[model samples]
Target: MMNLKYQMIIQWSEDKSFLVGFPEFPGQTWRTHGDNYQEAVNNGIEALESLVIAYQTTGETLTKPTFNQAA
Candidate 1:
């Protein structure tokens, strides 16, 4: 796999659902049905990969999210 240096924030919601999002990739978020944190991270990665491919096909540039903004 290619090494893509993208950062994302993963947290558990109040309802126990995993909330994942890449602040750099605005509007990109995904949720998975599992208690495992790793599962959530994997789902988030898949979501990001899809978004990146879509953006590339359309000639759109991806905006990198900063740590401050993600926080």
Candidate 2:
């Protein structure tokens, strides 16, 4: 997934009282949450790295990201 750049969608949930971020690829759901915006961004990066590692380890090709939605 070296050439791939996934978009991260972030939002603040009043109910959860935290920031949440997730990749925007099709079939992808859920997100990593954080106590603040910066933490949420950090979590999103970790999530993307984890995704890359998983795909690499399993020898599965990751779909190229269409855009970057991170803020």
Candidate 3:
């Protein structure tokens, strides 16, 4: 299990579904989506896991997570 902390942005799309995206990983805007909010979160987590695994399997460097400091 990968315990990497990354950003997952979920927003309602015009298609009437929730879209998920990872800001840390560029190039692709939307990765996984869902019909509802909960589903979107679940799909986002799965997508994040797969992304990390893919990066590791390919011996590629994983992007550093952005830490937002509390003001």
lDDT (CA) per prediction: 0.70, 0.69, 0.92
Provide the global lDDT of candidate 1 against the true structure: 0.70
Which model is ahead, 1 or 3, in terms of TM-score? Answer: 3
Question: What are the per-model numbers of colliding residue pairs?
Answer: 1, 0, 0
Please give the ranking of all candidate structures by TM-score, highest first, separated by commas: 3, 1, 2
Candidate 3, residues 1-71: lDDT per residue as tens digits?
56869999999999999999999997648999999999999999999999988899999998899999999
Residues 1-71, model 1: lDDT tens digits: 43456776788888887788776765655433336688877777786677778888999987764534554
TM-score of 3: 0.93
Clashing pairs in 3: none
TM-scores of the candidates in the order shown: 0.72, 0.71, 0.93
Model 2 RMSD in Å is: 4.2
Per-residue lDDT of model 2, residues 1-71, tens digit only? 24446777778787664555445555556567787878887787787788778888999887776753698
Please give the range of 10 consecutive residues that has the lowest summed lDDT in model 3: 21-30
**1 against 2, candidate with superior TM-score:** 1
The 10 consecutive residues of candidate 2 with the worst lDDT sum are: 17-26
Instruction: Give candidate 3's error at residue 12 in angstroms.
Output: 0.4
What's model 2's lDDT at 7?
74
